[model samples]
Target: MNKVPITVITGMIGAGKTKISNRLIHGIKGSNCKVQVLVYYPDTITVVEDISTKRQYRKLPHQEQPAKLITTQEQLISEMISYSKEKQPIDELIIELAAGIPPQFFVEELFQSLEKDMLDKTFYIQSIVSVIDAQHFWFDYTSNHYVIYTNDNDRMEHTFAEVMISQIEFCSHIVINKCNFISKESLDETVSFIKKLQPKAQIIFSADGQVASQTFHSVNDVDLHQIKSNIGWKLELKNNSSTLNLVEKFGINSFIYESHSPIQLEKLEEWFRTFPSEILRSAGYLRTYSEAHGLELLYFSQVGASVIIETVDEHCTDTTARSKVVFFGFDLKDVEVTQQLNQCLMENNNINQTVV
Candidate 1:
């Protein structure tokens, strides 16, 4: 049986992991390689559309980003591969995990369960990757997130920063996203900080979550248990230090604001012009009332003090007609931010009930 290479992508909630997954698979679509992509979101593993295929994308409403749910990992690796004697072959596979789930969980599980000769010989891990949000690295991560866990060994309180850095430490590659949003000097410091944590991992800077074709070929084995056995918190403390001081000294935090109400694009943009300076990054898909553009939804994202909103409904834009923007940084009172965002919402009677 020919071995199928698997690449595991993991990171924080908004670390560009999904975008990178789309790009990696899209880049390999036309190649001779036969590959399958599996994205493990919070609840289910979905087989997404081949965003590279224009025809498939055009079929979507407003040609918005195409996303499809897939069968579970058990189906692909065990049920399908175990019958390899009768099944057709798959050359490569990519698995993107849900936020907060570590990559090592899948790695250790596969090795333990795939011991049967059929799967043992056929399935192989290709690479592990973690995406980092460059602009928020300094002001959002650290403090209570890791400090709480460092003091108490409770995974329940594990911070996004802790989970994110662990993903980076265990992976073969680290992709620092939104590099263009920060100054070159700050980017250098971010890279240096990541280097101190994962010295051997390959670190790539990405302006928009795109990487070279060669990044997909790297396969590095990380011994998560071995690290746990030796040094332990001594090394783990470094991970906390990387982003802890920033959050502690700066006194900032992040949370997502999701509203099903359609927003007037013009009003939203106008508001962003004078939006609170505390917002480190705000990204989400929203509906626009403008009939001239014929666009039902638009994507808005602000990194640090800069906003990058696009009208294009390509695969890169994952925002829905409803908005779910993330606000990260300091001096943002929940009530004030919520009130300000509410003001940007459209006054129309139309309602999107997809919200909780």
Candidate 2:
């Protein structure tokens, strides 16, 4: 039996994954391929239009089908299995994972199912495409704000940088959408940064989400292990490198900051409020002192204008209390950032001296 190729579309919030999915549906229909889209949304309400009805209303040829809304993992898997068993199976399946929900989770699930022989032989993942917002990519990528998703009576939280980076790192293809909103120089820089992060992925720029159908059709099968371990940060961390040397190409640079002492809460807050614009992205773990919780281990994240310092949980058990953060930006001043962060450390009252 011929396997139905599945393409997963994902990106940060407002990056136009839905628009791209719709465009792909239209493009696939034009190519005379039967396609089905499954939209996994955190909320019950969805905006994926009934493209078939709209095409019929306009009397267009090869009317497309509507997208299915999926809210849980069980439902998504069941839907795919059912679709594969249909009398006239779809030529392609496009699963658009809503913004905020990491695409890795779904991709991992699909791989696990395939390994356990739970999925029909007629289904295979064709590509994992991440859509990026050209204009707001830097802003959204650097912000330290948390993305909260409530689904199936469970709440999940992840920093914007974490989610965005994961999406970029795990994908086989990247679509830089909304290119018209940014300058050519900015777009070039954005593309450069994405390449730095995911050098293996095929990248294409789009005015909106109008990518050629061939882009989707040309993708080769993704290697799950390579995609999982190829994250820029992971490579940098594994190499034990303190700095990246791309400052001349596009002024893109990165550095790792490490400290053993606890950060004073007041000073940390002050530092966050005055975070340098030069540092576009930073993420790691830190130890901080709070009046209510004394010495606590926390996760630190910063992207653009947003910053988040929150308690670490079981998921971060491997992370130590010692602070270690990876900072990425354009022409980052490692010394200046180091000094500022050092000043946020607690003072040793016993020795009447400040700890750095």
Candidate 3:
């Protein structure tokens, strides 16, 4: 049996993944190849349009292929396997993941299935396509809100910024949808930022998810290993490259803040309360010094209005374990910000000494 190619669509809650999937489905109307789409949403039902419906509300002579609604990962995999066994197997399959779920999680599952021979002869992942809302890209990307999902008695939550970054980092293609909603300058900046995030992915611009069908048809086979290691933060930290001169043209840049001294808990809290608006996203591991805990390692992350500092349970005494934080923002004053951070260090704090 011929293997069926699969394309996984991923994006945040208001991005245009559904619209893009609809467009893809419409393209298959006159083709000889059979196609199936599994729409996955944990919280609500998504109605995918049936393009095969006849005009004037009259029934069409041919059967309409409607998108199947899937609520769980197991169901998604089971449906794909079952579809492949049909008398007339589908030529291609599309899986539209929920906004709150990370693409990597599903990708990993698919790979595991392939290894265990569950999907090896039936289906293979062709590419990962991410949709972005051009108009609200910056705001949504930087926001600190959490994507929450509730199914009966089960509940789950994910950081909004983390989900946005993961979707961009893991995709093989990026669709910048709703282009007509933003100005030319804003669109350029949005593209520049995405390029920095995942420089390897091909970016396609569309006003209403009307991207060419050939765009999806001609995608190169994805290299899973490369995709896993293509994140911007990882590359930046590895190369020790502080700023991208090309991205600076749009007043957007990134830098790594590093220090060996421990940060005072009180000062760090104060800094977060008054975080600079220009610093859009910042995350790293840091060492904190408190009288009660002495020295401890903590994880720090600030995206838009959300700020998080939690214990990391790592040895802080190791000289090699320095505090390093990466900050990405617009028109950042690195030197000034560095000086301010220096003041928060334990070495710089004024401590009273009593001679006994």
Candidate 4:
């Protein structure tokens, strides 16, 4: 069975992502191939126009801003698979991850999760063609222009350059969209900068989105083995004493608290809901019931940490029942914050162990 090809289109806000997306869809339709295509728009931000009147884009199931549904690549891929499984003659699928996601925010685990499936079918990244608003690139990606308006929490997240560099490093193609507004010198310099970040990415300049179809062709037919070969792991977690060091580097320090003790269900749920702002991501397998046939809670932050539950296998030992959760951004080494959370999560005992 030939697995369908899926392309993930991503970009920052107002970078003309929707425009290029429509163009690609039309281009694919015009080809008149007997190929089936499904485009998964970021379930967070709403795009007003419909390219296909007959087949309305199926909105991914979510309660928050629909765009939020495209929160992680794994969720996007999982939803795509679920959708494709129900369709007949499933030929190809195209998904847009959404606007304004920093490169680090792209989950490494999600891609790893798909490595197995990519081998079974034709899976390719196609291209992560970021549309550059020439006029705003310097403002958004170079200077601290947008920081003045955001709250204290977001102000510490990432610099403009870091975000742009992250996106460029991962994208397979560089689409300098809406280039009519930029000077020739600026365009050359921008291209030079992108090349420094990712020399392998093919570069294309488009005015009103007129890039050739070949721009998308390089990644059109990728082998799963090739993708799997590119897989490697780089998780940065400093020793418990390095909280200050982590803070200096990432503006965040994370602590993972693992306890085998069975937390009270109501207390656990309440703690998850009222989690502090300093935590960027927190997750673990939770065991609260007697038999260990309980639920798992995953916590992560886009704007703030979100908690969700799913079933897990029965755990036999409460003595070995551990909750390893990380709290990023809160000065964990600070006797005040880490101690407070230690008291909060443990609630009744003295559990003071550092990242070391």
Q: Which residue window of length 10 is worst by lDDT in model 4? A: 231-240
- TM-scores, in order shown? 0.52, 0.72, 0.79, 0.48
Q: Which pairs, if any, clash in model 2?
A: 142-303, 142-304, 143-303, 143-304, 144-306
**Tens digits of per-residue lDDT for model 2 on 278-312?**
87667778877655676668887665666778888
Model 3 CA lDDT for position 162: 68
Better of 1 and 2 by TM-score: 2
What RMSD does each model have against the real structure? 17.7, 6.7, 6.9, 13.0
Query: Of the pair 1 and 4, which is ahead by TM-score?
Result: 1
- Model 3: weakest 10-residue lDDT segment is 54-63
Tell me how far the alpha carbon of residue 341 in candidate 1 is from the true structure, in angstroms, after superposition.
Answer: 46
Q: Write the per-residue lDDT of candidate 3 for residues 53-102, one digit (tens) a residue.
A: 31122232221357788987677777876776766578888888887777
Cα displacement (Å) at residue 140, model 1:
3.8
Q: Local distance difference test, per candidate?
A: 0.58, 0.75, 0.74, 0.47
Clashes of each: 4, 5, 0, 13
**Per lDDT, what order, best first?**
2, 3, 1, 4
lDDT of 3 at 305: 68
**Per-residue C-alpha lDDT of model 1 across residues 1-356, encoded as one tens digit per residue:** 56667777876645677678767766776576655666664332222222342121112121012433434456545543633554656666777676666677667776676675346676666677878888777544532322121113432334445455567557777899989989987787666556545556777889877876568584443454554332212243323322212333334444556666766666776887787866543445556555455336666655444456667457534445456554545555666777777888776543332221
